[model samples]
Target: MTSFAELVRYLAERFLQAGIESAALDARLLAAYAAGFSPEETVTKRDAALPPEVLDRAVEAARRRFAGEPVSRIVGAREFWGMPFGLSADTLDPRPDTEVLVEATLAWCRKHDLAGAPLRILDLGTGTGCILAGLLSELPNASGVGVDRSEGALRTARQNFARIGLDSRAFFLCGDWGDALADATFDIITCNPPYIETGDIAGLCPEVRDFDPLLALDGGKDGLKAYRDIVPQASRLLRVSGLLIFETGHRQARLVRDMLTELDAGFQTEIFPDLAGIERAVAGVRQSGGDGGRGKKKVGNPIGSG
Candidate 1:
């Protein structure tokens, strides 16, 4: 009988030969999932015989992964902010870089001593509801609305909210940016909008270009379409002292900041780098010359941030 350890090594070799990154990690994850055991448990049973049913499922999963499907999508979930969030094809996969936005928001809250405050949050293009879910997980008393233009994505986000036990505190809305929110004012607004340039879509890795929904990836002409829509709406949706946090394309930080700067000088904007030293998050606070909100001009995060 093939041992579980042998099976994982076999799958890892297949994945590596197929040019998939993180081959070992993916192999172990798929193996553990197919065996109906936690990854930790799988590691413990590595020397044991692999059940035929387990190997069967693992083989199928390997085929899909080899075809360029993201392991997260294949597994039907992705962990964000240390929590397992369900996924749907219509929604963008939750990513680590986007966590910078959550970290920024949380730091701003803590810096301003709003940790225990009851706050209202608005998330635009909230694919999988990861942004809202991540923030709500940290800011206990806060509740939010995750707005997405796609009905399928909206439903997925709603399901994610419920799955993470934040259903009662979070709701999903179908609309473009603030259209569905009307005059609703929030203390904080978060978004990880589509920022990939239209011309650049076809050049993306197959996992993103083929599997990720176009509505969640294609930003018009120069990749600033969603920014144009979201930035202006933030001015209206946010309360006087509200904060707007965004996850921008690695190279689009300056442009995003410039766009916001041109829209309203009332906002104090800051660009923050991800762990890789790439500027990945931008934060803006509406200021009316009087500490409208967390007025510090430092990078998005400063207090136990990241």
Candidate 2:
């Protein structure tokens, strides 16, 4: 029988040889999962021999990882905003970088004293509902509706909302952007739309290019297609003083900011960076009735950039 520690080391070596970046961490996670051990238990029982079945499962998981499967996919769940969210083939994997959108939204909510308000949120392209889940979890008085085009993605989002105990506070819709919603219905609209340029999809890391749904990856020729679609819809869906926030691709922040500004939507735009200092999220607050919803400006804030 292979001991848990031995299996972890073996898997780590193979993953390292395969050039997997998080080799050691992935190996341990796979081994722990196979053994049905919690992370803490995995540490405490590292020396214990894994049962034959457990060892077999761990090896199989290792093979899948070697084939470029993400550890989160292998485990069927991922942690985002300190919460575990389920995933599906149709849903884009919830990533830490995308958390920038959530952080910035939260910061804005705090600064505006809306955290405790019964805020209504609409999350576009809400794969796995991670963004909506994160916001709803943090803002206790907030409720949300998540919209996605994929039925499978919507199913996963529904499951995720239930898993996180926010089902009662959340709803899912199958539609194109805000096509299925009423005008000025939400106080906040968030999106992490498909932003990878169509031509650039082939160049993405295999973990993404291979596994994530194509509908959630292809952002058309300029990689700003989704933004173009969502922004116009957001202008109508968001209430006065409402906020529209989005996670942008590499160096795409300025373009996204420009889109919000150029539109006659009375938006006040801001750019925020992620931990790696890449401008990852852009937020725009819709101004009230003045200027007939045409006032626009660009600004910057440091609330959750890091």
Candidate 3:
């Protein structure tokens, strides 16, 4: 009979041999899930005998992991900003690096003395609603709208907001960029758009390329399509002095900044780095006089198009 400790070790070895990084951690996590225990609880129970059903479940999960499914995908949820968010085929798994955008937004809020203000936020490409939910959690009085093109993704985001007790303060919409949103309505806008170059997506690990929805991965041909579309709308959506923060691919921060600059929309831009010090987010403040001739710009499908 295999003990819990032995099964974990066996799984770890198999995972490592399969070229899976975080082999040990993944093994422990999958094993713990099979036993209906938290990963931390497994340490004390490691030496105990594994029930046949639990062992079988663990092995099956391990097979999925081996096939390149992410642990979060197998588990159907992921933690972002310390909150658990559910996932669906239409949504992108919320990742750790995305927290940089949250951090950047919060840092700016605090610096501007708006942390406690009743601010309005607009989250473009709100897959899973992680970014908007994270910000709303921190800003008690703030409310926000999450926009996504896929109805399925919006459904998952809505669930995520409800799960974290944030539904009352959040709304979800199906749309492209800001579209027909009222002008200067948001005090902050955050986006983590699909910026991966179409050609480079094939080079990403199986966990990403295979599992993450292509709608949330393909950024058109150049990888900056979403940014180009979103930045202009963000300038129109944000109020004077409002901030726009976006998560960018590695080395793409400079290019995004240049876009904000060329908008000539009275933006004051800055770049923020992730924990790895890669320029991961670009922030721009829509200064006074930055409405970018809002009155003359064309509108798209209405906000309730869904």
Candidate 4:
């Protein structure tokens, strides 16, 4: 029988040889998952013997990791906005960069005195329902609708909302953009749509290129298709003074802002930076009925060129 330590060492070496960036961590995670123990517990109990079935499962998981599957997908979950969310091939994995959109939205809500109200929110392309779930958790009085084009992705979002105990406060719908909510309007709208140019998908890392849904990555020829669709619809879906926020590729910030301007001449727009100091989020607010000058001047870029 292969010992627990021996299996871990073997898998770690294999993952390293396969060019996995975090080989040892992947091996440890697989081992801990198979053994039904936390990662720290696995390390503390490294001398423990492994059951044959457990070892087999660990080995198989390690092989999948070595084959370039994301560790989040391998583990079937990921952390976003300080919460755990389930994952599926049906949706794009929630990324840390998307937290920028949440942060900007939250700041806007606070500034507008809407943070504690029973605000209505709409999340487009709500993969894994991370943004909606996190927002609902933070703003107890807020309720949201999460929309995705894929039925499978909506199913996963529904399951995740239930898992996170937010089902009662949130609704999941299957439709493109805001179509499912034809007669509804919201105080806030958020999205992290596909922002990669079609041609660039081939150049992404294997974990993304091979495993992630293409529908979640390709953003048309210049990586702005979703922005074009989202901006115009947001104009119709938002109430007066409603806020629309979304994540975008770092290089596409200027173009996205321009698209929003052309979509709605009255939108007041700004950009927010990610942790890496790159401009990664674009936000716009509907102007109140008046001679609406653009609400705010462009702030200095917050995200670094990462």
Candidate 5:
């Protein structure tokens, strides 16, 4: 019988040769997953005898890793904002950078005295429903609507809501931005839309560049296409004094800020830094007394439109 220690070493070396950056960690995580143990537990039992089935599953997972599948997809879930979310290819795997948008949104909600109120929220392009689900998990009194263009993605989000026991507090809509949500007015709106420039997609890591959905990536020529559509629509969805929060590429903060300004949306906008200290989130506040200029004029379906 092969020992866990020996299997770890074999998988780690194979992953490294496959060019996975976190080869060792990935090996341990997959091994632990197959053994029904936590990664921490795997460390303590490295010399334990591995069951044949467990060993085979671990090796198969490693082979998938070697082929460049994202570990999140391999394991079928990811942790975001301290919660585990089920994932699928139909959904964009939740990312740590997006947590920056969550933190900023929470801070803004606190500052505006909306933290504990039963405020409505809209999550545009809500892949895996992570943003909306995470926020609802934190704010018990909040309810939300999650919109996505992909039916598969919406199904995944619905599954996540039920898994997290948030189904009663959340609604899933299948349509492009603002179309399925025309009558909704929210106190908080959030999104992490596709912002990678079309040309830059080819240059991303194979894990992301190859495996992730192109509909969740290609941000058009300059990567600001989603911003243009989302900004105006978000403005309309928010109640007066409501907040609009979004995650953008680090270098596109100023450009997004400028776009929000052009909307004349009565928003007081500011940029928030991510863990890397790069400006990764931009938030705008609908002014207390100003009109949102009749909301977004229905533009031809931006995302989730087939």
Candidate 6:
């Protein structure tokens, strides 16, 4: 191609023919990634001819994309909470909907005037460590430990935190849920666990079904396995009045809330919608104990009616 625009359009047409819905945007992003340039730079230089090496890179990326590999997988990164996170074969790519968990936690902290205090945070099923890293970026005084069952996921998570200069404030551990946490309690605990049921896994989109790790997607028979595995531990892992924020699968908010409530009577739950008006997240506050009654505060939903 003689120009970046031409390259992008060519790639877009290929992707379109391949039945990719976000063809144009994906093409542009892939071209920029392959060319070792920012998407903005690619846009600005759209009319310029690509270097032979860059064209080769773009061609290879297109081939992979055509083969059903996600652009994030081909590019080895995905942006979450406006920051780049490295990806691993075993880690779930960060999804925009998961950001609801971060937003909710931040709002909870702000409402309780806990944002400025030295706080410990925990992230179960950390995946790309997106939730923990995103929270640390906003809560300056917060230090977090991200626990994942996959060592590969942990490695990529560490890379992401270090890439964004949050490594000093972030710790990664390999374990299933809160098993590694012991008696340690935190000001906020977050998770975006695998909530897609095993039977439903086959129906996921190509990117999720083929590119995302099964370990990060399969939630058991009813998609409630992770909830069952996490709720009881989370109840113990949170300090009295601490917050537990997590993302759930479609239509999972209410059931997940019930699971938490049944697991611990101390927690008071609130469900919030994502930007798309879907109830995608639930946050529970540990009530009772020394200064642990924030659940009784009238802090309304932080992410109000979407």
lDDT values for all models = 0.84, 0.86, 0.85, 0.82, 0.82, 0.84
Candidate 3 stretches greater than 4 Å from native: 290-306
Clashes (N, CA, C under 3 Å) per candidate: 1, 0, 0, 4, 1, 0
lDDT string, candidate 3, 17-87, tens digits:
99787999899888888888776668787788877999889989998998889999988889999998999
Candidate 1, after superposition: displacement of residue 204 in Å?
A: 0.4
Residue 201 of candidate 2: its Cα lDDT?
94
For model 1, residues 1-306, the per-residue Cα lDDT tens digits are 888888889999999998888999999888887887776788688898977988899999999998889988888899999988888989988888888999888888987889889999999998898888889999999989888899999888888777779999988888888898876999999988898999999999988898889999988898888898878777678886678888888599998877765655367778888989999988887765543333435444333334
Of the candidates numbered 1 and 4, which has the greater TM-score value?
1
Off by over 4 Å in 1: 289-306
Task: Say which candidate scores most in TM-score.
Answer: 2
Deviation of model 4 at 247, angstroms: 0.8
Residue 6 in candidate 1, Cα distance off native in Å: 1.9
lDDT of 5 by residue, 151-267 (tens): 999999999889889999999888887777777799888888899999899999888887788999988999999988888786568887787888899599999977765665656
CA deviation > 4 Å runs, candidate 6 = 289-306
Model 2, range 1-306, lDDT digits (tens) per residue?
788899889999998998888989998999988999997988799899877999889878988898889999999989999989888999998889988888889888888788899999999989899999999999999999999999999999998888779999998999998898865489989999998999999999999999999999999998999888888776678887788898999989999887776666567778888889998988888866345335323344523333
* Best model number under lDDT: 2
Residue 55 accuracy (lDDT) in model 3: 85
lDDT of 4 by residue, 89-128 (tens): 9888888888888877877777667779999999999989
Q: Which ten contiguous residues of candidate 2 have the minimum total lDDT?
A: 296-305
> In candidate 6, which residue pairs clash?
none
- RMSD (Cα, Å) for all candidates, in order, is 3.1, 2.2, 6.5, 3.3, 6.3, 3.0
Of candidates 3 and 2, the better by TM-score: 2
Q: What is the TM-score of each candidate against the true structure?
A: 0.92, 0.94, 0.91, 0.90, 0.90, 0.92
For model 4 the local lDDT of residue 255 reads 84
RMSD of 6: 3.0
| Candidate that beats the other on TM-score, 3 or 5, i.e. the better one | 3
